[model samples]
Target: MPLAEFDSSVGHSFGLEFDSVLIRQITEVSGLKMEQDVIELKQNTADGKYAIKKLPGRPKAGEVTVTRGLTEDNSFEQWIKDSRFGKMVSARRNGSIIVYDYEGMPIKRYKLINAWPKSLEISTLKAGDTSVLTEKLSITYESVEVD
Candidate 1:
Protein backbone atom coordinates (compact mmCIF):
# COMPACT_ATOMS: atom_id res chain seq x y z
CA MET A 1 0.00 0.00 0.00
CA PRO A 2 1.02 3.60 -0.59
CA LEU A 3 0.10 6.87 1.09
CA ALA A 4 -0.60 10.24 -0.46
CA GLU A 5 -1.72 13.73 0.45
CA PHE A 6 -5.39 14.46 -0.06
CA ASP A 7 -6.98 17.87 -0.15
CA SER A 8 -10.41 17.43 1.30
CA SER A 9 -11.50 21.01 0.72
CA VAL A 10 -10.73 20.80 -2.99
CA GLY A 11 -11.78 17.13 -3.21
CA HIS A 12 -8.58 16.24 -4.95
CA SER A 13 -5.55 14.06 -4.37
CA PHE A 14 -1.97 15.02 -5.01
CA GLY A 15 1.01 12.77 -5.66
CA LEU A 16 4.55 13.98 -6.13
CA GLU A 17 3.46 17.54 -5.68
CA PHE A 18 5.73 20.39 -6.71
CA ASP A 19 5.53 24.14 -6.49
CA SER A 20 3.79 24.50 -9.81
CA VAL A 21 2.48 28.02 -9.20
CA LEU A 22 5.93 29.29 -8.37
CA ILE A 23 7.50 27.36 -11.23
CA ARG A 24 4.98 28.75 -13.71
CA GLN A 25 5.59 32.29 -12.52
CA ILE A 26 9.34 31.91 -12.85
CA THR A 27 9.02 30.32 -16.26
CA GLU A 28 6.80 33.10 -17.50
CA VAL A 29 9.07 35.84 -16.23
CA SER A 30 12.51 34.41 -16.80
CA GLY A 31 11.94 31.54 -19.24
CA LEU A 32 13.32 29.06 -16.78
CA LYS A 33 13.56 25.49 -18.08
CA MET A 34 13.32 22.24 -16.16
CA GLU A 35 15.13 19.39 -17.84
CA GLN A 36 17.46 16.48 -17.25
CA ASP A 37 20.10 15.10 -19.57
CA VAL A 38 19.18 11.74 -21.03
CA ILE A 39 21.28 9.80 -23.52
CA GLU A 40 19.93 6.87 -25.45
CA LEU A 41 20.71 4.77 -28.49
CA LYS A 42 18.70 2.59 -30.82
CA GLN A 43 19.74 0.07 -33.43
CA ASN A 44 18.10 -1.66 -36.37
CA THR A 45 18.78 -4.97 -38.12
CA ALA A 46 19.26 -5.48 -41.83
CA ASP A 47 18.52 -8.42 -44.19
CA GLY A 48 14.75 -8.05 -44.19
CA LYS A 49 14.73 -8.22 -40.40
CA TYR A 50 15.06 -11.99 -40.49
CA ALA A 51 18.75 -12.79 -40.48
CA ILE A 52 20.37 -12.72 -37.09
CA LYS A 53 23.20 -10.21 -37.12
CA LYS A 54 26.02 -9.60 -34.72
CA LEU A 55 25.40 -6.97 -32.11
CA PRO A 56 26.66 -3.50 -32.90
CA GLY A 57 29.89 -2.36 -31.33
CA ARG A 58 29.49 -1.06 -27.83
CA PRO A 59 29.24 2.70 -27.70
CA LYS A 60 31.93 4.37 -25.66
CA ALA A 61 30.92 7.03 -23.23
CA GLY A 62 31.33 10.44 -24.78
CA GLU A 63 32.42 13.60 -23.10
CA VAL A 64 30.13 15.36 -20.68
CA THR A 65 30.02 19.14 -20.93
CA VAL A 66 29.36 21.53 -18.09
CA THR A 67 28.94 25.30 -18.23
CA ARG A 68 28.78 27.72 -15.35
CA GLY A 69 29.20 31.38 -14.68
CA LEU A 70 32.79 32.37 -13.87
CA THR A 71 33.20 34.14 -10.56
CA GLU A 72 36.08 35.97 -8.92
CA ASP A 73 36.97 32.82 -6.97
CA ASN A 74 37.42 30.21 -9.64
CA SER A 75 37.86 26.66 -8.33
CA PHE A 76 37.42 24.73 -11.57
CA GLU A 77 40.38 26.52 -13.13
CA GLN A 78 42.58 25.32 -10.31
CA TRP A 79 41.42 21.75 -10.79
CA ILE A 80 42.28 21.87 -14.46
CA LYS A 81 45.74 23.28 -13.86
CA ASP A 82 46.57 20.90 -11.05
CA SER A 83 45.62 17.90 -13.09
CA ARG A 84 47.77 18.74 -16.08
CA PHE A 85 50.75 20.78 -14.88
CA GLY A 86 54.06 19.94 -13.18
CA LYS A 87 53.44 16.25 -12.59
CA MET A 88 55.02 13.01 -13.85
CA VAL A 89 51.63 11.29 -14.17
CA SER A 90 48.71 13.66 -14.15
CA ALA A 91 46.21 12.84 -11.44
CA ARG A 92 42.55 12.28 -12.32
CA ARG A 93 39.76 13.79 -10.28
CA ASN A 94 36.51 11.98 -9.62
CA GLY A 95 33.44 13.97 -8.72
CA SER A 96 29.73 14.23 -9.15
CA ILE A 97 27.47 16.91 -10.60
CA ILE A 98 24.20 17.19 -8.78
CA VAL A 99 21.08 18.98 -9.88
CA TYR A 100 18.76 20.24 -7.19
CA ASP A 101 15.16 21.19 -7.13
CA TYR A 102 13.86 24.64 -6.32
CA GLU A 103 13.38 23.54 -2.73
CA GLY A 104 17.13 22.92 -2.49
CA MET A 105 16.92 19.18 -2.63
CA PRO A 106 19.01 17.06 -4.95
CA ILE A 107 16.95 15.36 -7.63
CA LYS A 108 19.63 13.95 -9.89
CA ARG A 109 23.35 13.28 -9.57
CA TYR A 110 26.01 12.01 -11.96
CA LYS A 111 29.27 10.52 -10.84
CA LEU A 112 32.22 11.41 -13.04
CA ILE A 113 34.94 8.83 -12.48
CA ASN A 114 38.55 9.54 -13.41
CA ALA A 115 37.48 12.75 -15.06
CA TRP A 116 39.61 15.44 -16.69
CA PRO A 117 38.72 18.46 -18.66
CA LYS A 118 39.18 18.00 -22.39
CA SER A 119 38.54 21.64 -23.24
CA LEU A 120 37.70 24.88 -21.49
CA GLU A 121 36.24 27.91 -23.21
CA ILE A 122 35.91 31.31 -21.59
CA SER A 123 33.34 33.83 -22.59
CA THR A 124 34.30 36.66 -24.91
CA LEU A 125 34.61 40.17 -23.54
CA LYS A 126 33.14 43.29 -25.05
CA ALA A 127 33.18 46.96 -24.15
CA GLY A 128 30.18 48.56 -22.49
CA ASP A 129 28.59 45.21 -21.70
CA THR A 130 27.41 43.94 -18.33
CA SER A 131 27.14 40.23 -18.86
CA VAL A 132 28.84 37.91 -16.45
CA LEU A 133 31.65 35.81 -17.83
CA THR A 134 31.00 32.10 -18.30
CA GLU A 135 33.19 29.03 -18.72
CA LYS A 136 32.46 25.88 -20.65
CA LEU A 137 34.15 22.61 -19.74
CA SER A 138 34.12 19.36 -21.65
CA ILE A 139 35.10 16.48 -19.37
CA THR A 140 36.18 12.99 -20.30
CA TYR A 141 35.52 10.26 -17.80
CA GLU A 142 35.99 6.54 -17.58
CA SER A 143 32.36 6.05 -16.58
CA VAL A 144 29.26 7.84 -15.38
CA GLU A 145 26.66 6.89 -12.82
CA VAL A 146 23.26 8.46 -12.31
CA ASP A 147 21.34 8.42 -9.10
Candidate 2:
Protein backbone atom coordinates (compact mmCIF):
# COMPACT_ATOMS: atom_id res chain seq x y z
CA MET A 1 0.00 0.00 0.00
CA PRO A 2 1.17 3.49 -0.75
CA LEU A 3 2.12 5.68 2.19
CA ALA A 4 -0.60 8.14 1.29
CA GLU A 5 -3.19 5.40 1.27
CA PHE A 6 -2.17 3.98 4.63
CA ASP A 7 -4.11 5.10 7.66
CA SER A 8 -3.04 3.85 11.03
CA SER A 9 -5.88 3.25 13.41
CA VAL A 10 -6.08 5.63 16.33
CA GLY A 11 -6.13 4.34 19.89
CA HIS A 12 -9.36 6.08 20.72
CA SER A 13 -11.17 4.43 17.86
CA PHE A 14 -11.61 1.02 19.41
CA GLY A 15 -14.30 -1.11 20.96
CA LEU A 16 -14.79 -4.16 23.13
CA GLU A 17 -16.98 -7.12 22.37
CA PHE A 18 -18.04 -10.03 24.53
CA ASP A 19 -19.18 -13.18 22.77
CA SER A 20 -19.60 -11.15 19.58
CA VAL A 21 -21.78 -8.55 21.26
CA LEU A 22 -20.35 -5.05 21.09
CA ILE A 23 -19.97 -3.39 24.48
CA ARG A 24 -21.00 0.22 24.47
CA GLN A 25 -19.29 3.29 25.88
CA ILE A 26 -15.91 1.78 26.55
CA THR A 27 -13.67 4.75 27.25
CA GLU A 28 -10.37 3.00 27.69
CA VAL A 29 -8.69 -0.38 27.45
CA SER A 30 -5.24 -1.31 28.66
CA GLY A 31 -2.95 -4.27 29.44
CA LEU A 32 -3.57 -6.19 26.25
CA LYS A 33 -0.28 -8.02 26.58
CA MET A 34 1.18 -11.53 26.53
CA GLU A 35 4.21 -12.61 28.50
CA GLN A 36 6.18 -15.66 29.58
CA ASP A 37 8.64 -16.67 32.25
CA VAL A 38 12.31 -17.13 31.40
CA ILE A 39 14.29 -20.15 32.50
CA GLU A 40 18.07 -19.95 32.73
CA LEU A 41 20.42 -22.90 32.72
CA LYS A 42 24.05 -22.66 33.77
CA GLN A 43 26.40 -25.22 32.29
CA ASN A 44 30.08 -25.85 31.77
CA THR A 45 31.15 -26.08 28.15
CA ALA A 46 33.73 -28.58 26.82
CA ASP A 47 36.24 -25.70 26.85
CA GLY A 48 35.66 -25.33 30.62
CA LYS A 49 33.82 -22.06 30.17
CA TYR A 50 30.72 -21.33 32.17
CA ALA A 51 27.76 -20.15 30.19
CA ILE A 52 24.18 -19.31 31.01
CA LYS A 53 21.55 -20.31 28.49
CA LYS A 54 18.14 -18.72 28.50
CA LEU A 55 15.01 -20.58 27.62
CA PRO A 56 11.34 -19.68 27.40
CA GLY A 57 9.26 -21.09 30.23
CA ARG A 58 5.56 -21.34 30.78
CA PRO A 59 3.31 -18.59 29.46
CA LYS A 60 1.87 -16.25 32.02
CA ALA A 61 -1.82 -15.59 32.19
CA GLY A 62 -2.88 -12.31 30.59
CA GLU A 63 -4.80 -9.52 32.28
CA VAL A 64 -6.63 -6.57 30.78
CA THR A 65 -8.23 -3.51 32.34
CA VAL A 66 -11.22 -1.91 30.73
CA THR A 67 -12.76 1.42 31.71
CA ARG A 68 -16.14 2.68 30.70
CA GLY A 69 -18.43 5.51 31.63
CA LEU A 70 -20.80 4.58 34.40
CA THR A 71 -24.28 3.78 33.27
CA GLU A 72 -27.34 1.85 34.26
CA ASP A 73 -26.10 -1.32 32.57
CA ASN A 74 -25.52 -3.95 35.23
CA SER A 75 -24.24 -6.72 32.98
CA PHE A 76 -20.59 -6.21 33.91
CA GLU A 77 -21.39 -6.05 37.59
CA GLN A 78 -23.36 -9.28 37.20
CA TRP A 79 -20.38 -10.90 35.54
CA ILE A 80 -18.14 -9.85 38.41
CA LYS A 81 -20.59 -11.19 40.93
CA ASP A 82 -20.84 -14.50 39.12
CA SER A 83 -17.09 -14.95 39.28
CA ARG A 84 -17.13 -14.93 43.08
CA PHE A 85 -17.53 -17.91 45.45
CA GLY A 86 -16.60 -20.72 43.05
CA LYS A 87 -18.85 -19.56 40.23
CA MET A 88 -15.99 -18.86 37.85
CA VAL A 89 -16.73 -21.76 35.53
CA SER A 90 -20.05 -20.32 34.47
CA ALA A 91 -18.77 -16.76 34.29
CA ARG A 92 -15.92 -17.34 31.89
CA ARG A 93 -16.32 -15.54 28.61
CA ASN A 94 -14.50 -14.97 25.34
CA GLY A 95 -14.10 -11.44 24.12
CA SER A 96 -12.15 -9.25 21.75
CA ILE A 97 -10.63 -5.78 21.67
CA ILE A 98 -11.21 -4.37 18.23
CA VAL A 99 -9.36 -1.51 16.58
CA TYR A 100 -11.15 0.41 13.89
CA ASP A 101 -9.98 2.41 10.97
CA TYR A 102 -11.02 5.96 10.23
CA GLU A 103 -14.06 4.69 8.41
CA GLY A 104 -15.14 2.76 11.51
CA MET A 105 -14.33 -0.66 10.10
CA PRO A 106 -12.60 -3.24 12.22
CA ILE A 107 -8.94 -3.44 11.20
CA LYS A 108 -7.47 -5.53 13.98
CA ARG A 109 -8.69 -7.70 16.80
CA TYR A 110 -7.17 -9.18 19.97
CA LYS A 111 -9.17 -12.14 21.20
CA LEU A 112 -9.26 -13.00 24.88
CA ILE A 113 -9.77 -16.66 25.72
CA ASN A 114 -11.50 -18.03 28.81
CA ALA A 115 -11.63 -14.62 30.44
CA TRP A 116 -13.33 -13.68 33.69
CA PRO A 117 -13.68 -10.53 35.69
CA LYS A 118 -11.08 -10.29 38.40
CA SER A 119 -12.09 -7.00 39.97
CA LEU A 120 -14.33 -3.99 39.54
CA GLU A 121 -13.66 -0.42 40.70
CA ILE A 122 -15.66 2.73 40.54
CA SER A 123 -14.10 6.11 40.25
CA THR A 124 -14.31 8.19 43.38
CA LEU A 125 -17.18 10.58 43.51
CA LYS A 126 -17.24 14.07 44.96
CA ALA A 127 -19.75 16.84 45.12
CA GLY A 128 -19.47 19.53 42.45
CA ASP A 129 -16.96 17.59 40.41
CA THR A 130 -17.32 17.66 36.63
CA SER A 131 -15.47 14.45 35.80
CA VAL A 132 -17.42 11.73 34.13
CA LEU A 133 -18.34 8.82 36.40
CA THR A 134 -16.51 5.67 35.35
CA GLU A 135 -16.03 2.09 36.33
CA LYS A 136 -12.91 0.06 35.74
CA LEU A 137 -13.05 -3.67 35.29
CA SER A 138 -10.03 -5.92 35.50
CA ILE A 139 -10.16 -9.18 33.61
CA THR A 140 -7.84 -12.15 33.66
CA TYR A 141 -7.59 -14.59 30.79
CA GLU A 142 -5.68 -17.71 29.84
CA SER A 143 -4.29 -16.19 26.64
CA VAL A 144 -4.68 -13.56 24.00
CA GLU A 145 -4.64 -14.13 20.24
CA VAL A 146 -4.19 -11.43 17.65
CA ASP A 147 -6.50 -11.80 14.66
Candidate 3:
Protein backbone atom coordinates (compact mmCIF):
# COMPACT_ATOMS: atom_id res chain seq x y z
CA MET A 1 0.00 0.00 0.00
CA PRO A 2 1.26 3.49 -0.86
CA LEU A 3 0.98 6.29 1.66
CA ALA A 4 -0.91 9.42 0.73
CA GLU A 5 0.94 12.71 0.63
CA PHE A 6 -0.17 15.68 2.68
CA ASP A 7 0.60 19.37 2.29
CA SER A 8 -0.26 22.11 4.76
CA SER A 9 -1.60 25.43 3.61
CA VAL A 10 0.64 28.46 3.98
CA GLY A 11 -0.43 31.40 6.13
CA HIS A 12 0.51 33.96 3.51
CA SER A 13 -1.76 32.46 0.88
CA PHE A 14 -5.06 33.67 2.27
CA GLY A 15 -7.55 36.14 0.83
CA LEU A 16 -10.25 38.30 2.37
CA GLU A 17 -13.50 39.28 0.75
CA PHE A 18 -16.44 41.34 1.99
CA ASP A 19 -19.90 41.51 0.48
CA SER A 20 -18.72 39.36 -2.46
CA VAL A 21 -16.01 41.88 -3.34
CA LEU A 22 -12.36 40.95 -2.97
CA ILE A 23 -10.02 43.11 -0.86
CA ARG A 24 -6.53 43.38 -2.22
CA GLN A 25 -3.07 43.90 -0.68
CA ILE A 26 -3.76 42.23 2.62
CA THR A 27 -0.51 41.52 4.46
CA GLU A 28 -1.63 39.70 7.59
CA VAL A 29 -4.73 38.46 9.37
CA SER A 30 -5.26 37.30 12.93
CA GLY A 31 -7.77 36.57 15.69
CA LEU A 32 -9.92 33.87 14.15
CA LYS A 33 -11.43 32.16 17.18
CA MET A 34 -14.59 31.40 19.12
CA GLU A 35 -15.17 30.57 22.76
CA GLN A 36 -18.01 29.81 25.15
CA ASP A 37 -18.57 31.24 28.59
CA VAL A 38 -18.77 28.90 31.54
CA ILE A 39 -21.61 29.03 34.02
CA GLU A 40 -21.39 27.53 37.49
CA LEU A 41 -24.36 26.11 39.39
CA LYS A 42 -24.52 25.05 43.01
CA GLN A 43 -27.05 22.49 44.19
CA ASN A 44 -27.85 20.58 47.36
CA THR A 45 -28.67 16.88 47.05
CA ALA A 46 -31.28 14.93 49.05
CA ASP A 47 -28.49 13.52 51.24
CA GLY A 48 -27.33 17.00 52.18
CA LYS A 49 -24.36 16.78 49.83
CA TYR A 50 -23.34 19.91 47.98
CA ALA A 51 -22.35 19.79 44.35
CA ILE A 52 -21.16 22.32 41.85
CA LYS A 53 -21.88 22.05 38.17
CA LYS A 54 -20.27 23.85 35.29
CA LEU A 55 -22.23 24.58 32.16
CA PRO A 56 -21.59 26.25 28.85
CA GLY A 57 -23.09 29.69 28.51
CA ARG A 58 -23.17 32.06 25.55
CA PRO A 59 -20.62 31.85 22.79
CA LYS A 60 -18.20 34.68 22.09
CA ALA A 61 -16.61 35.51 18.78
CA GLY A 62 -13.17 37.10 18.68
CA GLU A 63 -12.38 40.41 17.01
CA VAL A 64 -10.40 40.01 13.81
CA THR A 65 -7.43 42.25 12.96
CA VAL A 66 -6.45 42.72 9.37
CA THR A 67 -3.26 44.43 8.25
CA ARG A 68 -2.72 45.81 4.79
CA GLY A 69 -0.44 48.23 3.04
CA LEU A 70 -1.81 51.72 2.49
CA THR A 71 -2.94 52.42 -1.03
CA GLU A 72 -4.76 54.99 -3.09
CA ASP A 73 -8.08 53.38 -2.31
CA ASN A 74 -10.20 55.00 0.40
CA SER A 75 -13.22 52.69 0.24
CA PHE A 76 -12.18 50.70 3.28
CA GLU A 77 -11.76 53.86 5.31
CA GLN A 78 -15.20 54.99 4.21
CA TRP A 79 -16.68 51.78 5.52
CA ILE A 80 -15.15 52.45 8.91
CA LYS A 81 -16.37 55.99 8.89
CA ASP A 82 -19.91 54.84 8.19
CA SER A 83 -20.03 53.08 11.53
CA ARG A 84 -18.92 56.20 13.36
CA PHE A 85 -21.36 58.42 11.46
CA GLY A 86 -24.51 56.52 12.51
CA LYS A 87 -24.73 54.56 9.27
CA MET A 88 -24.40 51.21 10.97
CA VAL A 89 -26.74 49.40 8.62
CA SER A 90 -24.55 50.37 5.71
CA ALA A 91 -21.38 49.55 7.57
CA ARG A 92 -22.25 46.01 8.53
CA ARG A 93 -21.10 43.48 5.96
CA ASN A 94 -20.61 39.77 5.50
CA GLY A 95 -17.14 38.56 4.71
CA SER A 96 -14.91 35.50 4.48
CA ILE A 97 -11.27 34.62 4.99
CA ILE A 98 -10.17 31.91 2.66
CA VAL A 99 -7.06 29.81 3.12
CA TYR A 100 -5.59 28.40 -0.06
CA ASP A 101 -3.45 25.40 -0.67
CA TYR A 102 -0.17 25.31 -2.52
CA GLU A 103 -2.05 24.79 -5.77
CA GLY A 104 -4.00 28.03 -5.27
CA MET A 105 -7.23 26.18 -4.39
CA PRO A 106 -9.23 27.03 -1.34
CA ILE A 107 -8.69 24.55 1.47
CA LYS A 108 -10.53 26.23 4.29
CA ARG A 109 -13.03 29.07 4.58
CA TYR A 110 -14.33 30.99 7.57
CA LYS A 111 -17.51 33.00 7.09
CA LEU A 112 -17.83 36.21 9.05
CA ILE A 113 -21.34 37.27 9.93
CA ASN A 114 -22.50 40.86 10.30
CA ALA A 115 -18.99 42.22 10.46
CA TRP A 116 -18.12 45.88 10.95
CA PRO A 117 -14.93 47.74 11.55
CA LYS A 118 -14.48 48.49 15.22
CA SER A 119 -11.29 50.53 14.83
CA LEU A 120 -8.77 51.63 12.25
CA GLU A 121 -5.10 52.55 12.79
CA ILE A 122 -2.41 53.64 10.45
CA SER A 123 1.30 52.93 10.71
CA THR A 124 3.50 55.59 12.25
CA LEU A 125 4.76 58.28 9.93
CA LYS A 126 8.26 59.69 10.05
CA ALA A 127 10.21 62.06 7.86
CA GLY A 128 12.58 60.42 5.36
CA ASP A 129 11.37 56.95 6.31
CA THR A 130 11.12 54.57 3.36
CA SER A 131 9.08 51.86 5.07
CA VAL A 132 5.74 51.09 3.48
CA LEU A 133 2.78 52.58 5.31
CA THR A 134 0.21 50.10 6.56
CA GLU A 135 -3.21 50.13 8.11
CA LYS A 136 -4.60 47.89 10.79
CA LEU A 137 -8.32 47.39 10.90
CA SER A 138 -10.00 45.75 13.84
CA ILE A 139 -13.30 44.10 13.02
CA THR A 140 -16.08 42.85 15.22
CA TYR A 141 -18.61 40.28 14.13
CA GLU A 142 -21.71 38.55 15.45
CA SER A 143 -20.52 35.06 14.69
CA VAL A 144 -18.30 32.88 12.58
CA GLU A 145 -19.08 29.71 10.69
CA VAL A 146 -16.85 27.31 8.87
CA ASP A 147 -17.73 27.15 5.19
Ranking by lDDT: 2, 3, 1
- Per-prediction TM-score, please? 0.58, 0.91, 0.86
- Give the TM-score ranking, best first: 2, 3, 1
User: How many steric overlaps are in each model, in order?
Assistant: 0, 0, 0
Candidates 1 and 3 compared: the better one by lDDT is 3
lDDT of 2 by residue, 1-147 (tens): 221356555677788899667984789998889899999999999999999999999988989999999999998899899998669777899889898776677778999999999999999999999999999999999998899
Instruction: Show model 1 residue runs off by greater than 4 Å.
Output: 1-59, 86-90
C-alpha lDDT of candidate 1 relative to the true structure: 0.50
Highest lDDT: which candidate? Answer: 2
RMSD (CA, Å), each prediction: 11.3, 2.3, 3.2
What's the residue-level lDDT of 56 in candidate 3?
97
* Collision pairs in model 3: none
Record all residue pairs in model 2 with backbone atoms less than 3 Å apart, i.e. clashing.
Answer: none
Candidate lDDT (C-alpha), each: 0.50, 0.88, 0.86
* TM-score result, candidate 2: 0.91
> Residue 90: error of model 3 in Å?
0.9
Location of the lowest summed lDDT over 10 successive residues in candidate 3: 1-10
